[model samples]
Target: MAQQVNPPRGMRDFLPAQKLKRERALAIIREVYAAHGFDEIETPVIEDYARLHAGLGGDNEKLSFSILKRGLRQEQLENAVVTGTGDVLCDLGLRFDLTVPLARYYASNRADLPATFRAVHIGPVWRAERPQKGRYRQFVQADIDIIGEPGLLAEAELITATSAALARLGLAGCVIRINDRRLLAALLDYCGFNAADSDRVLITIDKLDKIGVQGVIDELRGFGAEFVTPAVKLEHILNSYSEAACAGDIALTESGIAAVLPADLAPEVTSALISLGEMVAPGLPAGVRLAFDPTLVRGMGYYTGTIFEIAHPGSGSSVGGGGRYDGMIGRFLSQSVPAVGFSIGFERIIDLIDLPPAADQRAVALIADKAVDPAVLLRIKAELIASGARVQIATRTKNVRPLLDRFELDGFTEFANVRPEHTSMHDLDFKVFAES
Candidate 1:
């Protein structure tokens, strides 16, 4: 009997093509971040349970995979129940995403970092999730964060850089839905709901795409009679925005919501959004659409200010989203280090489109006849390497086409083979071009 060789469920094993696409995507992302003056940083995959458990991950906290206490009393493992209260057994966990670890990193090294640090992070994060076709337990996220910039400028910068990167990767005119948790707070306040109920309401509202409108009404009823009004009113507000959003009347639509909101809160909300729009609108490239949606409630618990998500109708979910979490790092060091960021879903984008391979230096695969001289083969390989071609010497096999297919799949655009008794090596570009 052979041992099972599959990767763990909800995880993946990337072969040549899969690996190449991800790597090239990462490169394009990093290049964009670099051009904007962000420096790269690395953080450990495993973080203290306290950091991950800090009430910031939203629903992701529920999906974390905890590592059992090392050197544990064997008795503990034996006595532990396998459900619910079972979480007490773990001392550490793989990070759920790059942000929390970045928070910890900044707190640890803030003294030496720049006053306004634009940090780039690219890495894999894990979740103990149920496996699905496109969903995975392990996936890569590319993130950029600007720390210590207290103004709304940070949010504007993050949005601009991310929109540019996605555009560079061919995501033009993607709708970037924007909202502020402050706006959510104000809306709930106007409906006569308390600030404390905001988080619970947001958690339910975030599910609108999955659970439908009636489901949200049912869930809000759990909060008590007063909660029901906010739910009903919110429907009307977002419905109004949707109708007007199609006509490019964002300002007018928001003004309508302003009518029902608190006098002070309404003006603040309307002014901030209008200003943000003006700042981001002028230089933005065509095809990148920005919208002001009253209903955009990002699920993350740490978002304290503006919130955003990338919209792609093809997938029922946003491919990327982020928000201002100026308070997330304060939990680490007990002082505000204002920050904002955006993460493009590396895996989701890979699924949505073809990524051009990383730049190839005109690579050629060399296949030699068995009778060809070992000395001659070495010379051919050396000369090809010198001429800037990544040369691979194909192994002797029953059929050479399979080997050729394998090499071609790895991004070799041409093939070279030495013929026995031939005076010179032959090269073929192996590409088909239609008649012009």
Candidate 2:
């Protein structure tokens, strides 16, 4: 029996056509981001184990793939097992997301960078979780972060730049659902939930889309008798707001925001949210929307202020999300530096879009007969290439139809049949595949 050959589970290999498509889409994203004044940066794929597990990554920390320490003796392994400290066996881990590595990079090079840094980082990250449809153990993330900005301008800029990237990709009907962490905490407080249980409760509420309002109430009831009344009141409040929104009574204005929530909630959070909505509206492309979603609890624990997710009518899940992690950089820099970012779900959006091959370079397939001299083939190829066309030499096969079809699939725009007598570019006649 032969051994099976395949890529590792939850990972993938891309064919030439697939790779081209992905590259084209990524080029558009990069160009759009650069035009918005964000400079590109890169970091190592692996980081110190302690930094990866430093609680800034939220639940993603648990999903990181740890790298075992080199040259470990048997006695060290035995001791680790005996002490129940298996994590000590590893010294580094594959980064599970780009944000953590960016924070580390900024901390290490703060002196050389600008006072206010706008960075674009696009790279692959890994996780050790069960894979399913549209989910993988390894994937690419396209992230844009603004560091050293503490005002709503950072949030507005992030949202605008991300929207422009999506728009440039020809994706329409994207709605950026926005909310502040402070507002979520205020809502939980208003509902009478204990402060310590807020994280767990928020995790459940983040599932409101997956589970209905009644489902959330039932789950909260299971926590304890104390959660029952508050959960019920929460259901009532949500239902009333839903009805008002349906009736067109609510808007993104300050008074409209106030009308929807409890009167006792802090005015500062609501004011900030309203200001963000106003700031981002003028910059968005046509047909893209910006709306406030009170139940929008991003799963990351590091988010300190505004948090948001991109929702599209065509996607069953969020296509992208991010938030203001004002405290993340401070953990490494030893001082507070406000920051915010937005990441595009590259894998998900790639599936949603179909892009044509890049048109800037012309690709030509040179089909040569076996009788043609090797010198003639080399000269023809060089001449075509010198004329700014990508040329590939293919020996004539028994059947030419399949060869032409394969070349077309590989993004060749035209093909030429070469003979022994042909010695110059003018002797070879090229025919477009579509015409053939």
Candidate 3:
């Protein structure tokens, strides 16, 4: 017997029904995106290692699937500086997410795209990491982005469009948790923290969703005594804020934030929070609630302004998230191109949805005895196909029973037994065939 082949770990083969379900779901998502004026574009799956290592993707960069340089000589492989080149093994790697490639695409084709491009990209992204339910080493990300827009309008459209997509997918009670990186920066300054501690602190606080307040405190203590004092202050402030927000007291959460912010930045922070609430409330479709969480701290290193996440019950993790990455594309062109984008975690959302019932499309299995005339079998097959039934033809013999079983598995609904000499026929509906 030949050995069975398997796909790589954390990857999967989509069976026919599964593929159809996913395609139907993607069509719904694309419709929602297209309604919001986003145009589709595609980029290559592989990118230069230099781009992947460009410090924009945060921890996702560490999980990049790098490939070895082609035709490397012995000296290049052995020597660290054979020709003033470092011992770099890989020159290219698979893209970790669509956002990176989008940025690169925009950089290369800036002259062709619109001044403010509303783009949609739905495709697979590879991440070399542990795979579990709703998480994969190879998965699809559906992203819609607005580039060259500086105002909060881009953020508003992103949030509203994503919420609409989820609602169209029949997911109710979804919450959008939002925050601003500038607000976080202001808070760090208010706490008398250094600029260098910003990202580390943001990464640490991002874990707050997994670990509770005290757990965060303990971990911050690990960063050294400098983090302990701010951690204590953060613990007090965030506890008070979360309680108030949970108790349905928005004003209290506001006051708590105002108390911690510096006098100069406090007013802007308060106003931005209010604007976020207002922008999300009016155009956003039903079944979506927006929350302003000061502790959001999304780990994407490139998010320079607003950040948000969309989550629902049973997905274990957020089904979608993205934010303002004003600086990411700028890295390529050495010029700023304001961009805000959101991505639906395509596979995660699929896990939560049930494929709606399919409409009736009757199928036929035309079975003939081996002793039957071959011309008769061919005529029956053509007739069944012409009569709007999906036809499957198999010879009747001792081995035919299992073939009929296989036919049923493939969704054939009716079975016909044809004879050459007797000029008689036997017919069975799919249910009777199943029982026999």
Q: Best by TM-score, which number?
A: 2
Candidate 1 lDDT, tens digit per residue, 1-436? 9999999898878897678667777888899989988899999999988668878787798888888887778667666765456667887999999999999999999999999999999999999888887688998899999999988788788888988888888765477877788878877877666788888887887777677666777888877987877778776665545445433234423454464344567567568776777788776777777777667788788888888888775565688999899888998887777999889887777777665544554776777788877777777777778878777787567787788778777867677666556433443323311110
Q: Locate the minimum summed-lDDT window of 10 residues in model 2.
A: 242-251
Candidate 2 has an lDDT of 0.89
* TM-score to true structure, per model: 0.89, 0.95, 0.82
Q: Which RMSD values do the candidates have, in order? A: 3.2, 2.2, 4.6
Ranking by lDDT: 2, 3, 1
Candidate 2 residue spans exceeding 4 A from truth: 241-251, 255-259
Q: Write the per-residue lDDT of candidate 2 for residues 1-436, one digit (tens) a residue.
A: 9886888888999988788888989999999999999999999999999999999999999999999899999999999999999998999999999999999999999999998899999999999979888889999999999999999988888999999999988888887878889998999888888899999889988877777777888898999988888888788887767544322235567777877888858789898889888888877898577877777889999999999888887788889999999999999977999999999999999998878756776899999999999998898899889999998999999999999998998888999999888898799899999899
**Candidate 3 per-residue lDDT over residues 1-436, each given as its tens digit:** 9886988889999875577668878998999999999999999999999999999888999998988799988877767465555428788999999999999999999999999999999999899989877678999999999999998889888888889999888887777877788988988777666789888887877887678677777887799878877877777766766544332234313554465344566567567766767767777778777776677777889998888887676667887899999999999997899999999888888878875533456677767767878776676667666767677778787767787777766656667776666342223323435455
Task: Report lDDT per candidate.
Answer: 0.77, 0.89, 0.79
Q: What would the C-alpha RMSD of candidate 2 be, to one decimal place?
A: 2.2
Q: What global local distance difference test value does model 3 have?
A: 0.79
Model 1 Cα RMSD, Å? 3.2
Q: How many residue pairs clash in each candidate?
A: 2, 0, 0
Query: Candidate 1: deviation at residue 203, Å?
Result: 1.4
